[model samples]
Target chain A: MPSDSTIQVRQVDRYRWLVPKQGPMRVDGLVFADRRLMADVRGDQALQQVVNVATLPGIVGHSIAMPDIHWGYGFPIGGVAAFDPDEGGVVSPGGVGYDINCGVRLLRSDLVVGDIRPKLRELMNQIMRDVPAGVGVGQRDLRLGPQDLLGVLEKGARWAVEHGFGVPADLDRIESGGALSGADTAAVSPRALERGRKQLGTVGSGNHFVEVGYVDEVYDEHAAHVMGLDLDTVTVFIHSGSRGLGHQVCTDFIDVMLRATAKYGIDLPDKQLACAPLDSDEGKLYLGAMNAAANFAFANRQVMMHGVREAIERVLGRSWTKLGLDLVYDVAHNNAKWEEHQVDGRRRKLCVHRKGATRAFPPGNAELPAAYAEIGQPVLIPGDMGRYSFVLAGTERASQETFASTCHGAGRQMSRTQAKKSVRRDGRDLRREFEEMGIEVRAASFATVAEEIPEAYKDVADVVDVVHQAGIGRKVVRLRPLGVLKG
Target chain B: MEDPLGPGVREVEHTADVGIVVEASDFEQLLHRAAVGVFALMYGKADADLGPTDLFNPLGTRVHLGASDDQGNQAGMPRPITVVGSDPAAILLKWLRELLFLHETEGLAYRRATFDVVDEERVSATVWMGPEPTPAACEFKGVTYHDLDVTPGVDGWRARVILDV
Candidate 1:
């Protein structure tokens, strides 16, 4: 196994390192990290995956990695790569990950920290009951028939809004207006459809959660204000994805892409990177299916948000609307989208894949909603439940360097087995530990909490600092979790 | 029945997700042990126990066994489980994916599995769908081909797999 000392890296700047393009690589690899984080990154196989990605046909700029980069299947988590369709660039299922459009949503409320402190336990219990969580646990009330499921695939979050889960205005605050265009229901498989039928409005286990927090500090006052964030104001964060539907979609497409890879004669360094040309029949089908899955994910989070609103209202004895519980913004961390970026001084159309990275579009980008045109896109980075999360704003430097991408989260620092072993060896009571910190945590099982211990992840503040220093994203506000509900 | 391969599995360290290493005296035993390892990882050893069952009615009358022609409706059926692949590696991948799908969609936890036919190209197994178990510690999204290997070693047949959680 290659170690930190074995990997070759040339320092590009204080925050950027270049893995010089060599061997079969078509482009250089760029990783953004400071000295301390770079040491951790080099200790894993993530940089090697970056090099493998560079070997893919039609790669643009550099195979990029955010500071939070870690070992993943084909592309490292926190890896971003763009491909030119006209140049035989392809889309790989591994690049988008299994949980299609797995993303985060933030909801800001009028209530201050003082108002929710005393009722935090009640509110957490309310959310735990209202939201179906854990593996295979679905909302019995939200089950969809075949036809209704098709509507979700086609309309994404709009389906939830039309179903009266939320108002149509919520759609505008979401990326791609809560639905990706060109989603073809017919392209989705029966298994995928079946898996999605009863799984809507669920938070599946492992790192996914519904967190209640407060804005503890504001780094960029103007941007924070634009995002409806105020110091000491309570907020809600939903972290989940399309559930079984998306996993089935990715599984189905991997078989398709494997065949496509052979037909296109594309040699692969890793089978997980199986792909086909973007314009090929196989590629187009995968894209359509993937988009449909992405839509389902959008609707899943939207529905869950509705449930959260209901829970909050029931607990507070006030209507959600009356409390000003409105969505601030929603962004997908796992997806591939057709975007235009400047390359070699020429504007080119490319398909950008962000596996475990978030889109950080600069202010003035036409894609920004009118309200955020001056403040840039709102980026929510949720840290471990015990510590604090951050809100960031997209920067012009990100657009110029990394196809407008930034780190997703703190990223896992320890394996699940390692975490469990540590907990058992030390005989630590994870729940009591969190309670000691004054954070209430309700989970399906204590084992889940042990695996998700704050020690298992890097300090998100450090991750955020690297991106902020690299100028990919600018820090806006810091959020401290008061209560958390996990599956 | 005398065992041809010793039964044992261990969790391997993976940076992001869960990884397991399974070993047996032959390929068939390796597959069985891998399934055991997966269930153990999801729910722990106490809940991973398997009950004895007849092959013809492995899941009993509780599960409906019928073939669905429509692709979307396939996950609705719980039996007559037949999986085909081009090679041993593909077969392993398909088998693991099927187990994950069943666990995620049907709420079926397998306590025992009996393979009627096992080869490089096809596998037919009757998995006894036991009572729904407690919530798993973690949810495995899917199996990946990343660094997946199934080969014969000096001890027996060995396989390594990574599960996306």
Candidate 2:
């Protein structure tokens, strides 16, 4: 086991590096990045985390990382790992992270940039008022009791729709129809329930936001059309997760996995990588609880989308349907799912864990909605609020080489403390900086704006270019932020 | 005035989240100061003149302060809370998590904290909490064991914690 500084990396292609199998590794590790990005990747402990992921039981192919890889709890952010159940595969709570099914949702509108420009500030103010955000801020209007909360845990987005939060059609565009099946409410702990009761539609804090942007570039006109994205059209992106409930789920299960590791006779390099065999009782319990939490997140985003639609309608003097504010796609970046894939030329059932990675199923995959059958899954990569985000379509190469996963975002280049310190040292007002770029910023506190300055993150265009050039994902459209709301 | 905890907590560099390093001459002081660090990160510093009554009384029945403090002031002290874990590391983890839970659920922010018991497994502490003056800059989701370490060297006991923000 070499340190990050001494680790050996062999560049296999223009955008991929192979960390060959060594001591105690069941398979090799693969990192997707070009030379420039790889330098930053090598400078951190993320590569070591990649190596650590390879030692897990029943790992297949390679422990893969997207270009946005960064040091995280156990598996590196933007990491993807899969295991075959028939081969003693295991499930790890740390691999899915604390915020289960933390994801992004994009909404497209018929209105163009011209229509939104004059009303951007008013719209942002309306959204900030409608959407509950910041630390421990619960939705004032949508508190749930135990029984209704149970329905949310069980039905996911369906519950929100049934409660008049969203339309039934909205679920069609969401991942897994906006709900993961097999969610057992019994698996959810009382403490998690208490934490979740008031947080259903809230955005919480740190990196989560609601951004109003415009599609500025379309690289693939056909795919862009399929996704309802046109050049200069208005769009909204919602980034959030299950909040306190999901955190409690992960905390509860990490303790279970810690005990399960010794019982299952598994060895781990990091305690955060605690796991249990997929067939074991502990694994089954975690999967049940995790699915419930993921469902909570799905419903969370669904409800937030409803609030966004209302805000737009209230500000623009039109109904959401008249505004064409339809859901483009909702995709989870942090999750574990059971899916069938071709492994060793044989169809096998495996549990795929994508920590900070998006599912980018290619065209014609069974899981995709009929509308997206010919164009592939829509992959939304939101960058810093002041810069740009991206819309990409999945490629066959992604399905074959990376377990249908791609980068989640630009990835952080600096620590929060470092970003804040640099802002103070340079005497820069981040809000003014964004304003200079014609971007409107609204946040609960000044510290958040400083810590999330564009410089704190890598250029998202560079990250998308790597995946596009590597044939994992094809560029479809690019979005530039006009108004941003931070928790 | 000199600080009792003595230069205890400092921020550590992390790419995606917040990290902190806490040091003290003894384990009990380490635990007490770590509480201070977590609260400070969550709600900033408390005013020096604010007492426990000024903090905890607002929460009413939600808070239970067990006994009087060193000054024989019942209003200025919080009830003792005890937690048991497998080891010192686990005990520290539990202690921090309990505080986070209180903050998220009850919106309580501690003005001061003290540890009465500190061994390998069991811990008892008292915290004087008040309503947060403002929202936190960011929310810490949970504490992770990623590269977590608690060690005692010649100078004092030290611990590194990575928080999921």
Cα lDDT of all candidates, in order? 0.85, 0.86
Model 2 CA deviation exceeding 4 Å by range? A1-3, B1-6, B44-80, B114-116
* Model 2 lDDT per residue over A1-487, tens place: 1138777889999999999987888989999999999999998899998999999998998899999999898999989999988889999998999999999999999999999999988888888878877776787777798999999999999999999998999999999999999897898999899889888888888999999999999999999988999898899999999999999999989989999999999999999999999999999999999999999999999999999999999999999999999999999999999988888888888999999999999999998999999999999999988889999999999999998889999999998877877876787655557778988877766677777889999999999999999999999999999998887
10 residues in a row with least lDDT, candidate 1 chain B: B51-60
In Å, residue A442's CA in model 1 sits off its true spot by 1.0
Per-residue C-alpha lDDT of model 1 across residues A1-487, encoded as one tens digit per residue? 3454655789999999999887899999999999988888988788889999999988999999999899999899999999999788999998999999999999999999999989988888788878877766777577798888999999999999999989998998999999999897888898998788888888888999999999999998888888889899899999999888999999999999999999999999999999999999988999999999999999999999999999999999999999999999999999999999999999999999999999999999898899999989999899998999999999999999999999999998888767777877787766567779888887766667777889899999999999998899999999999998876
Chain A TM-score, structure 2: 0.99
Candidate 2 structure quality by residue, lDDT tens digits, B1-165: 543223688778889988788998988878878878877776533222221211211212111111121123234337467888887788788888887876777666666677777787898878776665555667889988886778888998999888999
Worst 10 residues of 2 chain A by lDDT: A1-10
Candidate 1 ranges with C-alpha deviation above 4 Å: A1-4, B1-6, B46-78
